[model samples]
Target: MTEVRSTPTQRVAPEEPPPSDPVAAAWTDYLAAARQLDGVRRGAATAAGEQARSVQAAREELTVVRARLAAQQSRLRERGVPAMALVPSPPEVTVAARSMAAGPAAVLTALRTARECADAADGVLDARGWVAVVGVWRASRPEGWPDRLRNLLVYGPLAVLGPVLQVVLVLTGSGARIALAVLLGLVLPAVAFAVGWVGVGRFFRPGPDGRLDRTPRFGVLVCGVPAALCTAGILVAVLTG
Candidate 1:
């Protein structure tokens, strides 16, 4: 009976000190850093995009100015005034010194003095006037169908072959036609360049500062892209034929 006696034991409940954990604080800090990094990355990307757009905008502005200058020159030609007169003059002032020693009104002397003043004033006026004229001229020139088509016709092929002719010959062994293709290639782009220079001169106007008022990238693209496409077409036709 004594050997059958057993000892009774009490159980103590386990304690949890607090709900807030250090791990959670670390996680919060990590998330904050991640968010800040993301914000900085986004800001940089935005700035880069804006800068690209600004550059494109500036290019466009120059083209517009060129067009305006051309138009103004054309208009002046109609009025018998040289287009150059519309151009701004350098800002050098001319001084005419007069002496009272010439004596009492001296009708001949007065007439001479008057003429000199008039000539000086006219020169100043012409310089300023031309600047305005050129500005207007550039603004009004047209960039229409003919100009676009011409550029496409010329630059298209050259743009394509200018960079790829050698590659094609090495791969295809079409050496016989290579010279011909190259010739064709060079011609089209040369024509396009000439067209562009002339067309730009024809349409765009200048500003008061004698600068083109608008950018011509669109015009350039219009000509350039088409020429490229034309080249591709020609190449494809020749290859497949």
Candidate 2:
């Protein structure tokens, strides 16, 4: 009978970790710090979702590979091969095993990773949902009474003033009525146009893309509609009288 003695094991070089993306790491760290400080999230929904999916996919893949490794080990043992030689397991498998053992007992070897994946998904989903809900609520909220009143002060009186003054002057039956009408017709429109130009421009201050919005919405709301209504009212009063 020949006795075989175990030889001293050769030191295997450690597996180097996968190279990391520096800019991505920096941004991720920054985002984590921001989140810890309760700051607003950037790229909330889409980015978080992708991260969760990546983790889940990794966990699933690892689970499948580890299961295959176990079956392969069993097959080697049944075939009278030296199964115990490679029994120590790979570094990735070791780390995963430690985490799994340290955690609650589970049927699957990748349960620890799966739980981590679930947690990551939950946190991101909650944050994204909360941000969306707040955004929608803010959008749907009506303008405050104070702002509306302030705007009315700026626009309402201007609309009524011209019509009232013209009506009063026309009712006086003075020979100057014709000249007054001509002056009002030209001057009032010019005033409305000037007011519209200034109001609309100012309303667009610090506008998007550093470009001023010259849209007629504000101008029409503040000046055009009022001027039209007042002019119509004045015309009606003059003709009826």
Candidate 3:
């Protein structure tokens, strides 16, 4: 029996059959993966662009911020604000401390109360074009000859006197005429600036609430122009002499 028996055959399980549309299935999977990868790539690129734009805008804004700060610093320097003025203090400020508390306190308290009352009363100023207080308070009246003469008497001499004093000071202190002339040169421009600052503030301002007839006048004509003209004449005389 052993001689006649055949070797035992090995048994193998059948493999799973491939899908009928195997190529289509593989192509579908490949396309889905490609779409997912494309979505991720687009999102990353968009985020990078948005970040770059934000950074660029911030840089541009920084330049404007720096310029404004520099201008403010320059103004403060020109005004010569004291270091002590920058020291932090309580919100309450007392103009006079004499006797530690009395009439001055009462006056200041009254003034503050009055200001608050005025502001509250005139809260509609912008809405009413500044007529909400005291029956339409107005600008400084255009002055006639007498008033003009009075102002001129007060302000005109300042233009001439300031430059004269500066020139005299230079003449007395300096040995060389050239140095004196240079100082005069510097002083005239300074006088022009001073005259313009004061004159424009006091005389050339537009009327209250920017009225129709409130166009600014040439305040410089009263002070700056005269000073400049006189300085020019003096310059010519001194240089020629």
Candidate 4:
């Protein structure tokens, strides 16, 4: 009862500690700022590297595309296309530039697409060239001429050389010359066949690296038949005359 009427105890909240040193707080803030700045610098470096790589790749692709286009232009010119026709128009160039306005990445993509198109064009040109050559070959030869017949044409002239020489020697009325012609007939046909074989391989080849059916056995037959017949005929004439 002594304190029954005493005043209620006053409640006091605990005081917070004094503020930290100003220099330490400032140093902490400075560290955070430095870390942020370092992060920014790293991000900038990464972006710059990627951009540089894209630019370099675009340049390489452009070089390749230019070389391909130049070669194609030369080929087209040889095929009678005008140089002006091969050049890109101003509108096309403007459109291409607009397409790559976004960045070097876009430029690289455009160049790669152009390279693929150029490769396809090269394929088409090669096909057309092959067709043109084949057309010429077919037009020059007889209709429906097979490989054998075509090759025989090459060997025909060479095969007849021995017989022609024999005929000339017989006309000269020299027995020794006729005998020499007979000896030549044996050796000359082989030589002619060799020459014709090389000629056919060179002339009838389809492309720069293409091979054709040389038909060696057939060529031998074509070359030998004329010489054999001519030699037999000459022998008969010599014995009878």
Ranking by TM-score: 4, 3, 2, 1
Local accuracy of candidate 2 as per-residue lDDT tens digits, 1-241: 9999999999999999999999999999998988876643456665677666756766676676567556555755664769557466698677766766633233243654555665565576568669988988855543222334434444555555655666667677774884485457546755764664565445434333565444444444655564556556666765786
Give stretches of model 2 more than 4 Å off. Answer: 1-157, 217-241
TM-score of 3: 0.30
lDDT (Cα atoms) of all candidates against the true structure = 0.56, 0.59, 0.53, 0.85
Off by over 4 Å in 1: 1-20, 77-85, 88-241
Question: Which residue pairs overlap in candidate 3's backbone?
Answer: none
The lDDT-based order of candidates, best leading, equals 4, 2, 1, 3
For model 3, the superposed segments whose C-alpha errors exceed 4 Å read 1-18, 82-241
> What lDDT tens digits, residue by residue, belong to model 1 across residues 48-94?
88666655654555455556556555755765987668665554211
The estimated TM-scores of all candidates read 0.26, 0.29, 0.30, 0.59
Candidates 1 and 3, the one with greater lDDT: 1
| Candidate achieving the largest TM-score | 4
Residue pairs clashing in model 2 are none
In model 1, which range of ten residues has the least summed lDDT?
Answer: 92-101
lDDT of 3 by residue, 138-187 (tens): 32333322344434543566556656654665456454754554556556
